[model samples]
Target: MNRISARRGGASSPIFARSPAGSKRTRARIRGAALIGSLALAGAAHAELLKFETRPDGPNEAVVATVKLDGTSHDIAGTLAKPAKPAKPPSGAKALLIETQSSDDVKPLALERGLAVLTLDVAKLPDKARAPALRDVLGHLRGALKMKRVLGRAQGSDADAMTDAASAFDGLLLHDANREPAAPTRFIETWGADAYWREKPRVEFANGAPPNGRRFYLAGIAASTTATNCAAPVNARPSAPALRALFAALDEWTAKGVAPPAARAPLDADLAPAQDLKWPKIPGLPAPPEGARRVPKIDADGNEIAGLRLPDVALPVATFTGFNAQKNKKGPPCAAAAAIPFAATKLDREKNLDPRPALVERYGSRAYFVATVRVIADKLVKERLLLQQDADAYVAAARSAPF
Candidate 1:
C-alpha cells in the first residue's frame, strides 16, 4: 500500500503506515489515525473560516476561502456567500450550494435565501480526472462543514463529470450540452431545440446502482447551452426564475426529507413557423453556409423558444435574441445575444423594421403598461415560474420604464 499524507491549517502528517502482516501495533496505529482524522474534521467543521473581500467590478464583498481536497493534496479555490443572518438550515441536514465553474450568477439569490453559496473551479484538472477530483472536493467539504446535503450546478461537458460525482451529494442540478441524459438517471428537457437545449435530471444511481446512502433527488432544471447563459446579462437571464423555483423546492425536501413529486411534463416553446422564414439576402454580406442551424426563431407573438419567459419577454419592452453572428468566421459559432431597444416614440416605431407598437399602442398609456406587467407577474407567480420577490421587482421596474 502507498503512504498517504494529510495536511490541514499549514500542518502536515503521515496518515498511513505500512506494517508487517498480522502486526497488532500497526493495526492499532491505523485505527487511531482514522479516529484522529475524523475528530480533526469535526473540529474544522465548527470553525467558520469564510471571509469577505471586495470584488474588483463591484462594491459588494465576496466570501472567499481556500479548500484543500481531502486526499489529493490539491488546493481548490472556493468562494462563499452567507445570508445577513444564516437561516437555521434543515435539522441534521447541512446544505451546500456548489458550482463547478468559477463564476456563479445565482450566488446573490442563494445568499439572500440564507444558503451558503460555494463556487469551485476544477478546470485545472484534466478532463478524465475531474470527476474523481470533484468527488474528493465534495468529501472534503462534507467533512469540514458537517454537511449532509449538497446541491450542485454544472454546465457543458462538465455536466457528465458532475453526474458521476453526484454520488457524493444528496442532490445535483446538471445542465448538459445537447447530450441526452444517461439512463437510470431520470431526465426531462424543459425547453429549446433538439440539437441545443437543457436537461434537468435527478441522478440517484451510477451505472444502475446507488453509490451512497443518500436518497431523494430533488427538483432541478438545466439548460443545454453554457450554464452561464442562465444569468449572465440582466435582461437575458431567464434561468434566474427557474433557479429560484428549484431552490424553493430543494428547501422543502431538505427540511422534510421527502422527494418532490414526479418531474413536470416539458413545455414545447419552439417557434415552428420562424424556422421556415428566411431573411432577405444582404448585398454586401455573404450568405450563411448550407446546413447551418437557424437561430433567433420567434413565435408569432415574438418570444424566443426554450427559455424562462421573464417580464421583459412577457410584457415586451424590447426584442432579445440569445444568439448573434460572430464578427469573424474563425470566431465562435454564435456571438452572445443582445437586447435591442424598442422604439419608445411613435416616429421611431414607424421607422423600425420590427416595430413594437404594443408598448404604446396596445396598453394605451404608461400606467396601463405598468398595470399589465403586474397582471403578468401575478400569473407567473401562480405558475411558480417567477418568485414573488422578483415579480414585484419586475413590476416596479416596468412602472419606471419610459413607456
Candidate 2:
C-alpha cells in the first residue's frame, strides 16, 4: 500500500489526525465547515422596519403596521425591497407615488419591475377622517401659491409644506427653490374627469397621484386599457403622440404661469429637460410609462390585457406581429418567446450576451427576480391561468368579477 499524508481544514496540521483506522480527513473538514456556517447564520438578523411619520391630519396618518419577510400581506409597504443600488430620482425629480384603489400588491408587480412605486392605501383611511384631511392639504398648497405671488417669494416653510405634502402623497416633489419650474403646474386630478362614467376605471387610483393634486393622473380607473384602446376610436386610447402631447401641454402650462391650486409653478429653468426616450413607434403597441417600461406586453388580440411582450425580438416591429400557428404549421412561440432574445448568445451574426450566471450575480437581484418571475409566469401560463386565449381580453375589462 502507498503511504498517504493527511491534512485538516486545508492545513498541514494534525487536526485531521487519522481516526484510529486512518480514515480520510474529509468528514472532519465537512463538519467543521458546517459548524462555522451555522454559527455565522445564527448571528445574522433581518433589518429593522422603518416607520412612516404619519401625521394626525394626513392620509394613513394613524396607520400602524409591520412587515415580515416570510409572512405575506396585502400592504405595499410591507413588500418593500431594499434598494439594490444607490439610485436617486432624476434631478429635481421627486418620488413617483402611486395612489390606486387596487390591492397594493397588484400595482407593485408593475412597479417592482421598474416604474417608481409608492402605493397609497386609500382603504386604510378611516371614513370619518378622510374629507377634512383632504381639504387641509389642498388649502395649504393653495395658500403657499398665493403667498409666493404676493411677496414675490414664498416663505421657506410654505415651500417646505408644499414639498412635504406632495412627498407625503408620493408625488414627485421637484425642489424648485432656485431652479425655474420646467412645466406648468396644471392639475390632473383623477376624480373630476368625465372618463370615469364611460368604463370601469382600470387605472388603480391607489397606484397613482393623489386625486386632489395638480399632477397628470394616468387615471387608472378610467384607462386601464390605454395600451390596447390606443388604436380603438371608440375607447379613446392614449396614443404615443397623446403622451408626448401631455408633456408638451405641461411645458406650455408652465410657460404661461397657469398654476393650479394644488400645484406651484415658479420657473421653467428649475426643472430638468425632459429626455426624448425612444418610445415604441409601433401603433397599437402597449408600452409602459417611464420607470415602468422594463418589460411591456401587448394583447395579441385587439382587446386589452395585462401582458408582457415577447422579449428580445431580433427584428423589431412597431405593432403586434406574430406568425400564424395554423398556416405557419409551427408551434406557438408565445410559450418562451419573451425570454428567447435574452437567451441567445449570438443573433443575426452579432455577438450577443454570453448566457452566463456571472453577469446576473454582478447586477444584483433585479436580473434574478426578472428571470425567476418570468419562469414562474411561463409555468403559470402553461399549466395554469395564462393560456386561455381570452384571458388577456377578460382581464382588460375594468370591473372585478365576484366569486
Candidate 3:
C-alpha cells in the first residue's frame, strides 16, 4: 500500500486522515468564480441590444424607447422619416440629431438629408439631472449603433438642459432666449424687432479647457419669441425658414468638418453700442433688489439691437418683438411675443400708433416682393445657410403669402 502523508492544522499523519471538508469549500470557491464570470458575460451581451418600440403613425414611424442609466430608466419618444435607400452607400457618417422636445416640422427635412432625428421629452430630468441622463443616452446610442457623431438641437427650457449636457456631444444647436454660457456651444435666439430684451455673452473659456473646449458660435434672429414655433398650424411664423437654414449649416459643419462662419457683427445685447440709453422699469414691480440688472436698451429706431439679421428681418416683412405683456392682469407677467405685419397701405399706417414702413412700400409690389425673396434666398444659399431645396420652397411660400 502506498504511504500517504496529510497535514491537519500542525500535526502530520502517515495514513492520510480523510482530507478535511475544506476541499468542499475549495470547490465552492471555484464554482463562485465561474458564476461571476458568467454573469459579467450576460451583462455584456444584454448591453449590446437596447430596446426601442416602433409604432405606425400614418407615413411616419414613431419610436418609444427606454434607456437605463445608473440603475434608473428614462423614457424617450421620437418620430422617424427615413428616405428610400440610396443606390450607393452614404458617403459620410450617419448622424443623429436629438431634439429634447416634440418633433418639429424640420424632422422631415433632416430625413431627406440622410439624417435621423430623435425627439426626447426630458421633462422629468430637471436642469440638474439632464447632464447625466443625456450622457447615458448618448453612450447607449453610441454602443448600439456605433455612431461617431451626434448633434443636439433644443428650444426654450430644453435648450437650458442641452447646455448642461453639452460637453459630451459633438455639437449643439440651441434656440434659447435665456441661454447659459457653455464652451463649444452655439446660441441662437429669436428676438422681436421691437422688444427691449437682449442677450449678452455670459460665459467665456480660457485656454480651451473645461465647458466643452473653446468653440463657441452665436447667432440671433429678429423675430418674436413665438416665431420659433414652426409646428404651429395657423400662426406659423417666418422663423421656420431661418431655423431650417441654421440646421442646414450645422449639418454641413458636423458632417463635412466645414464650420459656418461666425457672425460678422456683435450678436449680443451690448446696449452701449446701440446708444447709451436707459430702459424704464415697469411701474408695479417692486424695485429690483440689490445687485439687480437693468433691462437691455433699445436703439433710436426702437429695435432691440442689431443681430444676425435673417432675410425676413433684414429685408422686412413685419416687426417682431421679443417680449409681450399678458392680456389678462392675473396671467403670467409676460405672454409669448408675436409678430405684426408691416402696414400694407397708408390707411393701415394711419390706424397704428407707431407704424413701420409697409411691406408693399418696401418691396414695391407683389411681383417685386417675390423677386426680392428669390434674391434673398439665393444669397442665403450661397452662404451655405439655406439648402437649395429649402430656399426654393421658402421663395414659393413668400410668393403665396398675403402681402
Name the top lDDT candidate: 3
Q: Roughly what TM-score does model 1 have, to 2 decimal places?
A: 0.63
Name the better of 2 and 3 by lDDT: 3
Q: Each candidate's lDDT (Cα)?
A: 0.48, 0.25, 0.50
lDDT of 3 by residue, 1-403 (tens): 1122334356532321112356654553333222221011111221111234445567756765454443455665666554555564242677777877665546666766666677766677545445555654565555334466677777667766666666556777665434543655543333332223323322221232233222222222333444232221111244566666666666666667665644433333443422344323222211211222333344322334444555555455544444344445564443244344556675666566434555565667888887888898788788765668777886777776566
Q: Please name the candidate that would achieve the greatest TM-score relative to the true structure.
A: 3
- Whole-model lDDT, candidate 1? 0.48
**What lDDT does model 3 reach?**
0.50
Candidates 1 and 3 compared by lDDT, better number: 3
User: Model 3 residue 300 lDDT?
Assistant: 27
Query: Tell me, what's the RMSD of every candidate?
Result: 10.5, 25.2, 14.1
Candidate 2 on 1-403: residue-level lDDT in tens? 1112233356432111122323434554443222221001111221111112122322222322222122222222211111122264221222122322323322333233223333334244333222222222223222221212100111122222233223222222221121112222222322111121222211222222333234332211122322221322122222121122222223223334433323211122221211223322323232222232111122222111222222111111112221101112253211100011122222321343333222223224444434543554454345322333223322332122111
Please identify model 1 stretches exceeding 4 Å from their true place: 1-75, 80-87, 90-92, 102-104, 112-114, 176-238, 257-297, 305-307, 327-334, 353-358
Q: What is the lDDT of residue 194 in candidate 3?
A: 27
Clashing pairs in 1: 197-224, 198-223, 198-224
Clashing pairs in 3: 192-320, 192-321, 192-322, 193-320
